[model samples]
Target: MQNASHRIRVYQASDCPELTRLDVSKLGRAYHKIPKIISTKFDSIEARLGIFFLKKYRLNALLSNLTFDIDYHCKNAQIFSTPYGSIGFDINRKFLLSILHTYYGLSKEGNTVSLDLTQSVTKTEDRLKIKLGQELLQLTMVKEVLNETLELKNDYTSIIHQWPYSVRFWLEGYDEYCFSILLDAHHVDLLLATSRVDSESDEPKAKNLSSEQIEHMFNNMPLTLTGRLVSINLTVAQLLNIGPGDIIPVSLNEPLPVFIENEQIFSSVVAEERGRLYLSEFNDKTPEMKYE
Candidate 1:
């Protein structure tokens, strides 16, 4: 059942109009590392599996025939239900028998394992199926992604009639084995969103510039410098009574304050040569007072 507000987008080409479904091609374009992720995880699964499997033999699972399908279904599919959703794996009897043969340390040269597809599944095969499914979920970190804390339920019936989307690939090392991972729109959306978030978070953030670097950058900029030779305090009456041809006596013996605009930064002494007054003896070691 769908909500009343839900709308279905229709696709049109030429003169014909068609109903649009899940666009898996868009997903393919968005994420191309799905195959690599599966292959890498599958290849290294044996290492993280267990001491018995590690000390005995490595499965060395290799991925091939990677594909994405919409509206996929499989008969005799073993499903494991989690809190978030359900995942399923489908393997034929022949493939299961091959895996069983490999599990028991049987040599492929001398060992003759029966490959009857019609044979009923045994208890041992069921256990192996559960173990392999659980291992796949763990190695791929699907459980962690879904935040599934409870153990997967096998006996429980899944609400999903047919998987909306599925990832089908072949695991080839010992023998060619077809593997199907059933997923729905929710799972696809979640995984894609998570990937995007991780990629965004992994990007390098802006770093703070050092004091020396900041100072070096600011030093390169052009600034206005003003020189103050002397300061004379005048009364309001003297300023108003000043007339033409009036001379104000001033001294140039002390060091004059140098300014960048109104802000004084250093001091310099007055020097006169050839009837021209100039500033000399720069000193910026100590802070200077503001020129009023």
Candidate 2:
């Protein structure tokens, strides 16, 4: 029997960039390219009538025009175990009604679209999932229409095969809706890893100080001192006669003045312990005598 060879693959977090927070402003700019208004006069008339009805019902005017954008803040966003990335959009109910009225020509005054006047419109998780599915379907339909019209399958299949990685929808002239394209496990892993790398790169690094900088920082630091004091009155003739072996008598009980940079700082008693000189009994008092 022959031994079989096997190959192993390794994955690292550093291989990917940090998952960046979605920029709503940039998404809004991209969404402006989409044609939202087919007929300006029809859209303007419908929008004006909608605005009048909204004010009559005391509804918020979030969407001023037929192609107006909605403001959305993303929260509780997570990459699911499945292929889809789940995100919650914080939006008002008036905004939802506005969308229905503008796009689908749904009446705002009907019992079918009844909304609580006191409570604001909020999308639940289930509702969001449903909305996401609908949006995905719409996107697919749009892509199909584009392909058919442009004859992309036969002519530009090589150039435009892959769906965009992400799509953003404008809400009240702002980027609000972000849809992440379904990705395979391998691609998802790479995206997350890249996000991590990007995040790590944004952090500030600790810089090392140079030798000169270190020296400059420590130059003004105070130093410890161990000092002694002695006084002797001697004539010029006596000082001239003094030799290396000459013994000058001085008081042993007197405290020595300790100095820090030529300034008398404190006084301490000099003592001997086991043939080693030691400073003891330190006090704030300075010596009465002064050096010339």
Candidate 3:
């Protein structure tokens, strides 16, 4: 690779414009769009579905990183029996959460509610719609399911390449809380690429053509040499037992995760001065950034 950077050029256009289903053309046909509404509660949906159980997000991130103009649905989330015990996973996030939309249709509007500094205002289904572009943003999180080889990027990519499938979704057209993974893949890809400069010959590109002056632009970021986030989240009971002593659990250790688009590009340490929080930075420059 040029300057020890991964220069990516591949792109993926999802099978259907309607993201309620998996494009099983790559991952195989065994996967299908089977959405099941929790119907119970929305609190920590990803926790119940299990995201902290995921071992890694590299391949999933790569699959997602390469494309931007499609829709994917995280339809079926389940736990499977394995020798290692019950393994649960979203199994479809590569197509869903990875491909996001900047714009969407907003349904029910929300009213402003007042809150107190010390008042406990939590675990509420704040059913509010925020207009994006062609689609509306709904409650979303990276869900997980039981899996064995999830840590291996290639095995995952191989399975995804051969049998790409979509999930069953309850889209946002009619309802707001109901979810789907509809996205402007083209736009997403364009933006992700814009974050990186491929080569010295790379054209003057970017949505605003002002990467040269972006305030957030950095020559490098911390590298995620080796790490993972595991089982986490506090139950209401755990949150309710507050009158006495308590300890909240977290999957992240010293170095928390960093990403351009939630892609887990690095692990960083958090610091604070008086009250405000800060993150320690390191070097992990992508190709385009190097040329710049």
Candidate 4:
């Protein structure tokens, strides 16, 4: 009797591009400043509306002391679109309610105000969600820092595909209301690009160094040089049959391939110096090179 063959599928944390540890570290550093930037922006708003005017008009509902944190996972995160890609996040419903209650002068001291999770959001609450989302996106410089052409997503959906990175943001005193944001690798790239540009601008202007000095500086920098001796292609059966100390015959092609950081640059021939082996006779083509 013949047996049926089946392939097994692998599951991963997300469908998006995988972030390396270095990428995660850079993103954490970049996002750490968000809360302070937002806080300053909020303070400016209050300053614009003088203390006397705010006291007299009773218009002091401005958001403050908000914090941004990193979240590795997310649930029920709302999806929004940007020029580069989509962003997913969900604010804590209770926190939203608290903000609304505070603005409307409602008592949130006890069970007097509690939201029913099963109940659908009212029109007022929906509007507030949209408004606040837009405001926060702007304050976080999602547009101003990345791209001015970027627009806040008006309509949002909780059903979204998993993204690689997430951030939890909330009002400092309202820890229960913390919201988590989900973003993919593209957004992180844009952020890092902006960050790089800013850092370059802030760096002291370069001094006038001669060509020789510049050459010397670069020559001192360490770089890895790689050489490929040969490559072998094998079928699964051939690979499975291999055993320890198995000698696989490989022919050396003239002017073997050379690489810089794993990228093929040129090819060179193997030569012997006084006491050491070296590469010489550089060329663009080799005898084993196949054209298709």
| lDDT-superior candidate, 1 or 3 | 1
TM-score of each: 0.49, 0.22, 0.17, 0.47
What are the runs in model 1 whose C-alpha is more than 4 Å off?
1-60, 106-109, 141-151, 159-161, 173-175, 204-292
For 1-292, candidate 1 gives per-residue lDDT tens digits of 9767978987557658333354433443333444444444443443343333434444445554455666777766778876656777666566667767877867356777667767677898888877776665555447434333446677446555587657665654535566567765556656666666666679875488789978997986646678887788899999998899999987763778889888878888888887777778998837547998
Task: Estimate, for each residue in 109-217, the C-alpha lDDT of model 4 and write its tens digit.
Answer: 4536665666778787776666666665554446444545567575354455555556555443444755555666677667666666766789886679889979997
Evaluated against the true structure, the overall lDDT of model 2 is 0.43
Candidate 4, run of 10 with poorest lDDT = 49-58
Worst 10 residues of 1 by lDDT: 45-54
RMSD of each: 27.4, 30.5, 24.0, 16.7
Compared with the true structure, all predictions reach lDDT values of: 0.63, 0.43, 0.31, 0.61
User: What is candidate 4's TM-score against the reference?
Assistant: 0.47
Angstrom error of the Cα, residue 125, model 3: value is 38
Candidate 2 residues 1-292, lDDT tens each?
9999999988698987444343332332332322232122334433543464355434333332223222333332222222232212223334444444444445544636554547543455335444534343223312221211111111111222222233232224434422323322233334344444555679875498789878986995547684856766789999899899888887554778777768778888888877767778999974479789
Candidates, ranked, TM-score: 1, 4, 2, 3
